[model samples]
Target chain A: MQAYANPTRFNALALTILPWCVGSTVLLFLVGLYYSLVVAPQDYQQGETVRIMFIHVPAAWMAMATYTVMALASAVAIIWRHPLADVAAKTAAPIGACFTFLALVTGSLWGKPMWGTWWVWDARLTSVFVLFLLYLGYIAIWQAIEEPAKAARLAAIVALVGFVNIPIIKYSVDWWNSLHQPASVFRMDGPAIHSSILIPLLIMALAYTMLFLTLHLIAMRTEIMRRRIHNMEQAEVQG
Target chain B: MSFTAPHIGFVLASYGLSALVLVGLTLAIVWQARSTMTRLKDLEGRAAKRRKPAKQVKPQ
Candidate 1:
């Protein structure tokens, strides 16, 4: 990890790992989709609509997970002063936001048929919505602030503070009477879901995770290149 | 699952929306990365050319 603090090393590492990540993402997604649409049994309650779980659930999981990744990188930027930390945090915001947006959209599509509504103000739904807003707010801070250091600090604070909502999003269904279903796959005891459904869901989650990793690496590399260009331009002027 | 099953439209919409968004995000990120890499390389090449002429004119 420390070795990657150098931009050159980080770039080389990202280049090496990127193809593998992309390849595995393709393979996992194919297998997961096969199981999701073909092997997983339809729910007695929701029927074919349950297939949407393969998409919605993984998206929701990634939305939360990517924010956590961002917050962690932000913390490193603040506490450890890891040079790549800020870039990691900065690059992650838009991707995380995209995933959160997808989660909301896909969740809505799932909700419309299962819950008889296109939207709801339930605890889980509302909390996840707040998370989406936080992502936007974090990204806005970066864009709004002209100073890089200041923007990094402000974005880090927003990310750390916004992390409080993650737990709320996770427990919202349990804490309040809500339209959203309680934990089935992630629980204290264990996943109550049948193996056929659970397997595909986990595979889909892996695929999403791989996708996130691939995008994140590319983004970090891009950020590094952008900074280099800025520095070089400044040098040309000063020289 | 089955197209004959109930609420199949919702299932399709969810998957379709997810696919669309994920693919779009991937393309956007990849494009940005490639653009940045290209710009950096271009800037480096220009800087190198500028340095070469200066070195030639110098005492060394």
Candidate 2:
């Protein structure tokens, strides 16, 4: 991990792996979408409306997972001062923000049909909303601060503080009597959903994971280039 | 998959909105990266040219 912390080495590694990531993301999305939309059987209760779970569940999963990654990266940046860690955290924010937005929007879309409400202040929903705000706040920190070091420091602190919300988002359904459904896939009772629907959900989850990997690599590369440009400009000005 | 599911419009809207937002965000990031790289390259090239003439003047 430390070896890759060097930006030059990281860029080399990213360049090699990026093609594979792109290829896998494309292949997985194609197969996953086909399986999700065509092969997966409709839910006995929700019927065709269950199709939304294919996209929604995976997106929500990515939203949570990306936040966790950002928090970890931020921690590394703060604790170890890993050269590339700040870049990783900064590059991840927009991608995670998009996923969080997708999760909320899709959740709302699902809610309106099932819960008969376009929006709700329920614990699960509210926690996820807070997660979205955290992403926004983190991004805004970077934009608001003029100095790069100061921006990264402040943003890292915000990311770490916001890490508290992740568990709440995860357990909100369990803790409260909410409209949101309890965990089925990761629960001890072992997947309340049937295999037919479960297969598509899993595929979609894989697709979302691959998509995150693909985007993260690209974002990191662009960030590295941006930093290089910044350095060159500084040198030019000084010389 | 029933063609007759209730709230089909909502489902479609959700997917459409997600796609639009994702595509737009991706494009915006890519554009910014490209533009920044181009500006950096231009600035560095000009700097190199200025240094080259200064070196010649010093030798004379």
Best by lDDT: 1
Residue-wise C-alpha lDDT for candidate 2, range B1-60, written one tens digit per residue: 456677778767776887787678768776877787687678778878987987888964
Task: List the global CA lDDT of all models.
Answer: 0.85, 0.80
Each model's number of backbone clashes? 0, 0
RMSD of each: 3.4, 3.7
Residues A1-239 of candidate 2: C-alpha lDDT, one tens digit per residue: 87897888988998899889878878887888788767987666665667777788788888889999999999999999988888999999999999999988888788777656677665566777889999999999999999989999899999999997667665764466445553422211123877877777888788789878878888887888888888877887787
How large is the i-RMS for each model, in angstroms? 0.9, 1.9
Error of 2 at A7 (Å): 1.1
Encode model 1's per-residue lDDT on B1-60: one tens digit a residue: 678887888888888888898899999999998898899889999999988997889985
Model 1 ranges with Cα > 4 A deviation: A165-191, B58-60
> Each model's DockQ?
0.89, 0.53
